[model samples]
Target: MAVLSKQVAVPKSGFSPIPVIDMSDPESKHALVKACEDFGFFKVINHGISAELVSVLEHETVEFFSLPKSEKTLVAGYPFGYGNSKIGRNGDVGWVEYLLMNANLDSGSGPLFPSLLKSPGTFRNALEEYTISVRKMTCDVLEMIIDGLGIKPRNTLSKLVSDQNTDSILRLNHYPPCPLINKKTNCGKNVIGFGEHTDPQIISVLRSNNTSGLQINLTDGSWVSVPPDHSSFFFNVGDSLQVRLIS
Candidate 1:
């Protein structure tokens, strides 16, 4: 029902860190896989996305949401009508709102997005700039994860992307502050942040606003916030990938 699937968060190993893939040396791959198998999540550095690009995207995001809801809704909505509407409808709203912009020109199709985001044919110049950069970054990470797994000839990554209906709609999420929520976790979810939902998308390069909220579940039952790392995209194994590991 949700674009993101729910996962029980109350476990014991809480917030384990994935091996930061160095990619600089031969040892990086083994470390990367070990981390993924152990925690299923990790923070990435040396990802090709430039700091300037992240800044611009962040800026544009803030600008987009700054508009009133009427203007915002034009972009898009979540699968079960979650992303753009008022919160309580989607677990108290998470104090955030967003839009999805797929980077692929022909790969992802829509009405998944609106005129501004899906303006691929009309090219808004500014949006195009952002699109190109995000797309490049998405592709780069896909390669590393595939390579890191040490699987070959099978091209599992390619299959994953193609199968997921690989869509890169940039989500512009807005988390409004609830007086109670503010106090509970700095306007964050008492550290519970957006619950523990595995992205339905093959890869969600979440580039969120400076505001809080957003944490991952650990086996130990502790939900840890993957603090906002400026200009960096954090990658985690989503539900499909996790299931693939299951069998």
Candidate 2:
């Protein structure tokens, strides 16, 4: 759900400070290429998904996470349904809980929704609508990326990523507020909402509530905060995509 990258400098000659691109612009293709090559991540605006839909999705997400723990546990299955940090055997734990669903149902071999959610028309409808919209946007961006890379036959990348049998997993993450912060107690133990790690998918699109916890490492070995903007989505080029592009 979150993508973290290690230090890799933007070459001095063509560095873009913000790495945001308006997909509607005529020159966005060139900008996309530069963003991928220089930063490996970028923010996208004018992506055709309605703001109202995004708001609805955010609200529904909060509602889902607000459900009673027992209710959520009905779908508690590793890598497929709802899960908490405790699911992992390692002693280390994070302050996050998540729900995972396949964005494209046709591509998924198993049931699209956990049994508890299947009967709720409202929840299912909202999630399905949001997933469809996101899938379209993701495909659109992938096409642009391929074009920007000058891949002969624009559909090459599209076909590779859009296989009807491959499901794109959508992970809804909720990072709970740390109680220790309010007490101001020095527990001497670090609390991480989500650990730092790179995404392994071809690409990852992330939208977060307007709180600034996301950080990416810089070439100078320092971490830089990525300011949260509720109005846009952050796009991360995953290792697979980078490999495909370069090869």
Candidate 3:
């Protein structure tokens, strides 16, 4: 009988520091390069998305999600996709509502992506700001990644990405408490936050702390913990980025 494979890596405390790089330091660049190579993931503290902005985004996310299920379902076009997407057991959605926004570099108006984005101020303003700020951070991070890869500093991380030069999207998600104490994959227990799958996004800039729902699959048949850090965004190259890099 074939069974699904699942393993979760709970983080061990020892780690390289969550970096806040100074572009001015020659050595700063080198350290960043090493961090990426050693672990495809790292936390960026002092990354400067103002507290006010963060607060705005957080407040709005809650306000938006709390609306009537019908209101949320208004923009629900994609599968389970109002403004939210249900990640495959491998995608990230099991029992969670998340924001899926695009910073359309190809499309002129950011609102060109969908109707939901333009609806009202609560979801509109914060998402717009979040999309912009996040993309800026993503663009800077990609350049650093290029440098770390020893490529020309101006190398295009994703060619034909867009005229805007970069397009960043957002996936804001929420995982309600799971009612499982001794939760193991299929070990006869009722526990779930999400199924299991690797992230397919190029970069992940999440805003979360301590609820501990996200996990990554390692090649060794184990799931690793995505350490929750509210202040810093977590970055990991997606399947798209990996494919581009490998090719």
| Candidate 2 Cα outliers beyond 4 Å, as residue runs | 1-16, 86-92, 106-119, 186-189
Candidate lDDT values, in order: 0.53, 0.71, 0.54
lDDT of 1 by residue, 146-245 (tens): 6776567445665444344554454455555445555645554453324445565555555544555557655544566666766555666666766654
Q: TM-score of each candidate?
A: 0.69, 0.84, 0.71
lDDT of 3 by residue, 19-119 (tens): 35554444555655554444445566556577778787777666667666677666554432444435534354466665554565234423322343334
Sorting all predicted structures by TM-score, with the top scorer first, yields: 2, 3, 1
Q: Quote the lDDT for 108 in model 2.
A: 52
Q: Estimate the TM-score for candidate 1.
A: 0.69
Q: Which residue window of length 10 is worst by lDDT in model 1? A: 1-10
* Total clashing pairs in model 2: 0
1 against 2, candidate with superior TM-score: 2
